[model samples]
Target chain A: MPGKVVRVRRHSNFGWKERLYLPMIFVGLGVTARHFFENFWGYMIGKVKTFVVQYPEERLDYADAFRGHPVLVALESGAPKCVACGLCEFACPTDCITILPDETRSAIERIPKVFDIDMSRCMFCGLCEEACPEEAIVMSRDVELATYDREAMLFHKEDLLRTEEQLGRRIGFIREEYNRA
Target chain B: MSDLLQAIEEKLGDAVEDSHAYRGDDTILVSHDRVLEVMQTLKDDSSFRFNMLIDLTAVDYLGRDPRFEVVYHLGSVEVEARGSEPSSLRHRLRVKSGVAEVPCEIDSVTSIWPAANWMEREVFDFYGIRFKGHDDMRRILLYEEFQGHPLRKDYPKERRQPLIGPRN
Candidate 1:
């Protein structure tokens, strides 16, 4: 006995009715008109209920759990709390993180001399945040990361460091989740 | 093992061997020479119409006689009531002829089922297993210029291939 052969033929009908798509066109126009008139009427009545907003001037409120870019946690002492363990670099599935451990540490035992994250390669998976032993690296809600050059997309340690004030919403969200758990 | 193994053995005597059921899964280990025949029989036979090829992969056992084991998961579309849910009877099969590491070769099953082409290519790409009758036998996962089989046990972990950008 042999394996059975499966034959599947596709039947597509492109008749005259399909060519004259006036009915479908009218149906689509009707839906658009209904939306336009409803939105216009709502605006005239001072309802202030429209789907589209004036972008660049206003933005929707994002959830606290939103994952965007990874940022270094800055301590109250004006120093980043990262221990330069290179765990984030190792744990990065896309290999976007690069942490060069500080060889010359006068007071601190270990810190990153050069911490680089190529934003182009990053998938925003939040694996680095999970890999952080000291909670030094966490995901930020700053998703507006457009740049003119590729070199600008490669964030350095200085650019990535964010104070507790900057990450207040996310820190509180994470703390609340931990407390609940 | 659902009487299917015994029926398969009766149909293709020496081709099927070391078949047993574990955790409700019926797994059969077959010799490499008659693997294509065994797969065809399993698919065409009315009693065991395992038409769907779920997956095909190869496992490298370092410091072993065969060095590599090819795994094939087959499923039949015939649905039957099992408790409250309907389920297909899927069978897992493993085959090995114990070839040397120099040129790991096995007869391709693409003649029976065309779905094995890409799968065989992937196995060849990762484990360096050569399928004799495969029409297009190229690296499916890795670049053509990739130095060595990454999944092989002997392949080094830290061996660096310097490129324009950083390592993946």
Candidate 2:
């Protein structure tokens, strides 16, 4: 059976009320004013809570599960915890991690001479963190990683180091969640 | 053997080379030449109404006889009860057929199910396993200029290919 093709003209002409747009504008303003007054009264009486946080002044405390940027853990003696195994580099799907292992005179014989992570290409999948046997490389809570230059985004070993105290919550969470010692 | 595999075996005796049910999965290794016939029967037969072709892909087993195995996942919606409100049940079947390394070809199931069109193209793209009688058999995922099948076991994972097009 042949199908019917109905030809119809597009309605381009607008109604008088739509063309004026005065009622719609006032309606939008009314909605905004209602919200403002409700929030104002609620704030004055301390009955309701506001969710808006002043950026740069007030920051949200991220959860332990929050995966932001990958960083290397540093011990209290000012030495990296990494053994330069290159497991994180291998686990990285984007090939954003680069490491150069060299022999060290420290307790851990092996250490990464040069470790670089390209933040621009990082997807923050946390596969590297899971693959780390020594728990050296971990996902930090540092979300504000914006930079002007591409070279600045390539974080070296020194720049990627974070003290154990700073990453205690995340380490504890990972150990507890993953059932690791 | 599961009921599905036994039924398929009884229906297409000679066509089914081997069949097994492992970990609640019904897998049947069909003869490469008669795969299309077996697939058609599975779809048409009332006992096993596999109306949906869930996925079609290929696995390259290097250092093995019949180097490639084309896998097809078929799903069927079965009426569980005969009551007024018929509850539907889902059954899945895995169909595998081995293809030789030298020729590396298999009859396309596109005629039985149209969804096999792009899927066969993808298998051909990744494993270089050509689907015979498939019209417009071209690369689906990778570009035409791609050197070799990247998914093959022998293909180096870290081997970097020269960048295509002009770069500043």
Candidate 3:
């Protein structure tokens, strides 16, 4: 049996002058300079520059319908709006909401005595807010809810229930959504 | 039971307390105490060789009799070689970790299935369930200094004091 062998091809070698490598260096510099100039021009014209909000100093405005942390509402009569029907508790898939009943209020049925919401466990499905029959619970736009301690994440009734005065500018948007047909 | 599953059931008789087949997917509910034996037999037996352990986790059904149920989803990659159709097997072992302090020890399946290490760690991190023979059991998601398991049903929502200083 006969075996076949393949021969390799060799290109022409560069001279001493060509091997100095000044041409390659110039080509590399030209490519880098072109990139630098393009980026600089685009940035100067404000085309490539990003317009991200600085957050703490300059925050991005959230939409009127942006459901965030569920807040307990207070009635105009200076009482808690939550009737403690346990609907919110039942609606919560994670079972983060725990409501303890109070017998003081007659009209509101039961008020949350030790209402605790584990924020860490909350998937924020917005079911609790939607399940509220009395419109007592609403998700706040304030999303900066970072906590150092796990225990700190447990939000009680007092912490979740926002007073009318403390509603801030976000409340106006919420009110607009509430009033919308 | 499908022909393959029936063969498995026949091979591992009495080991499986109850088996559920839904939507062509088979889930065998094994007792917690015999989980190790069941897993060992499933791996060793030629008919139903469940070599791969997919995931392990715990569910806190607070109001139920068994407050905590550790769910283990096992898969058999070697089914194709044993003249059985290729299908993943899920085995959920319900460990009744009682309401207050349920002290029940289920043998670690990690000895046979090495992949159970991370899954068991995750279960421990979230539900506070301990795997007896686990080499390194520590919090995976939360910091080491972090208090109670957040996934537990009783984890509190609010803090006594505000996380930050009062608004200016």
Choose the strongest candidate by DockQ. Answer: 1
Kindly give the stretch of ten consecutive residues in candidate 2 chain B with the minimal lDDT sum: B79-88
TM-scores of all candidate predictions against the true structure: 0.75, 0.76, 0.47
Give the residue spans of candidate 1 off by over 4 A.
Answer: A1-25, A46-50, A100-114, A148-150, A179-181, B1-13, B20-24, B79-99, B138-168
Interface RMSD of 2: 16.3
The DockQ-based CAPRI class assigned to model 2 is incorrect
Tens digits of lDDT, candidate 3, B25-103: 6667666667777778877876666677767777888777657777776666634432333333433222122222276
DockQ class, candidate 1: incorrect
Better of 2 and 3 by lDDT: 2
Give a tens-digit lDDT track for model 1, residues A91-117. 999999998887545465777888899
- The true-versus-predicted C-alpha distance at residue A89 of model 1, in Å, is 3.9
List native contact recovery per candidate, as a fraction of 1: 0.00, 0.00, 0.00
Candidates 1 onward: DockQ, in order: 0.08, 0.03, 0.05
lDDT of 2 at B80: 60
In order, what lDDT does every prediction score?
A: 0.81, 0.88, 0.71
Give the TM-score of chain B in candidate 3. Answer: 0.74
Using DockQ as the yardstick, the better of models 2 and 3 is 3
Residue A86 displacement in candidate 3 (angstroms): 6.7
Clashes of each: 0, 0, 7
Sorted on TM-score, best first, the list reads 2, 1, 3
**How big a share of the true inter-chain contacts is recovered in candidate 1?**
0.00
lDDT of 1 by residue, B30-133 (tens): 88777878888888888777877878888889998778888888777656645544454555443334445767888898987788999999999988999999
